[model samples]
Target: MPSLPLRAALVLMLVWPFLAQAQPALKVALFEVAPYAQKEGGALHGLYIDLVRGLGAGAGFKTEIALMPFARVPLALERSEADLTISFSTEALEGAAQALGPVALVDSVLITSLARSTRELPQLKGALVGRARGGCQDLAQRAELALRWTDISNFDSALRMLALGRLDGLCLTRDVLHHYSALASIERSRLGAEILVGQRPALLYVRRGLAPEVIAKLRVALARRSPVKAD
Candidate 1:
């Protein structure tokens, strides 16, 4: 028979391990955007969301997503407030965060007002171009041909600004723009014109200095997930 003191000690030992095993779960930051990262019915859902869930499951970790404004993603990652981010481009990850697999997600498009404008033709050279802040650096770098840029908070704002002739053009993910255009009931005729100036491959971004094992595990999981097809 065990003494009362021995039974108490045994109980403590068993409980201590469970408490020790309850480590903090990783936090992934997601922005409210369509087909990529968005909150639907109080839950995160999208292509990137699905991919991240799969990666988390394969890596044997719990991932909790926090939805933040699009402009704040870089700041959150830099401050270590978020463990991971999705749909960022290579150039975007350079100074912001360490990136994982290419993901090779969506392509961006250059959109110009269809109306005759004072700006140059076929491109935004020497014109004011509007883009979502912290969205995709690759598109911004390519659109630097005009040498002028305007940063907006959201896609709807960019579209409205362009429609109101406040900006010479807008650069955004092609699919995202189309989705918002439809949701906003934007008249197709209202848009001046658009051009597919270039394409960019998206990637998953993690805070710099994450555990190497964690990164390797994430990469392996993403590779097994395969490339996402265009919707």
Candidate 2:
């Protein structure tokens, strides 16, 4: 039993939601990996993408994600070619890059096909290791492996090389083995990976020279949630 003015006010209140605008443009970069960054049917989808989308929505911004090979990700950041990059190990945050928040803590491990011979760290001498370019997981220990490094651009290729026994080991986050193998129809039971090193904290890195306010907003958005997905 509201009066005419009250009825009109209530109608306006309900309509205000429809009149609201969409989020503003916020450019984001994503590498080809899953449950983190994966592209299918001309659209980006994954856990990290979801987490960023949540942040963008919560912070009032629209996301413009660019999918690229993992190796090319840091190069894009080094050249200030991207506004933001999906999470990566802090060790790779070189050049003018600055980390925003810890997005995930994943077990970065070395994987090999079960058929291939497994070796301990000391036994890795003279062994061939495959890893993504621009990655710095165990670059410091490369000399210990006699430094036979083969930079790969795609996960399936690296796994394929391992299955073919062409590479002694391929190091990456363990989730890559679980998700990418399912996508590529490679059986996971046929492979094994060990934590060649300790867990790594993955964080989003923004190239220097970006607006401080934008970086601050992103940091606050992520810090509030911690976005800590243990993968």
Off by over 4 Å in 1: 1-23, 90-92, 116-123, 142-144
The TM-score measured for candidate 2 stands at: 0.79
Write one digit per residue (lDDT tens) for candidate 2, span 71-118: 667777777777777666635555647887777777777775565456
**Which ten contiguous residues of candidate 2 have the minimum total lDDT?**
136-145
What C-alpha lDDT, on a 0 to 100 scale, does residue 200 get in candidate 2? 74
Model 1 C-alpha lDDT per residue in residues 1-231, reported as the tens digit of each score: 899999999999999978756955668887778868887787778877887777787876778888787767777888889888876664445677987766655666667776534334434567677776655465556544644777777777678777877777887878888988887778767777676645666677888877788888788777786667556
Q: List the residue pairs that clash in candidate 2.
A: none
Best by TM-score: 1
- In order, candidate lDDTs are 0.73, 0.72
Clash pairs, candidate 1, are 113-192, 114-192, 114-193, 115-192, 126-146
Summed over model 1, clashes come to 5
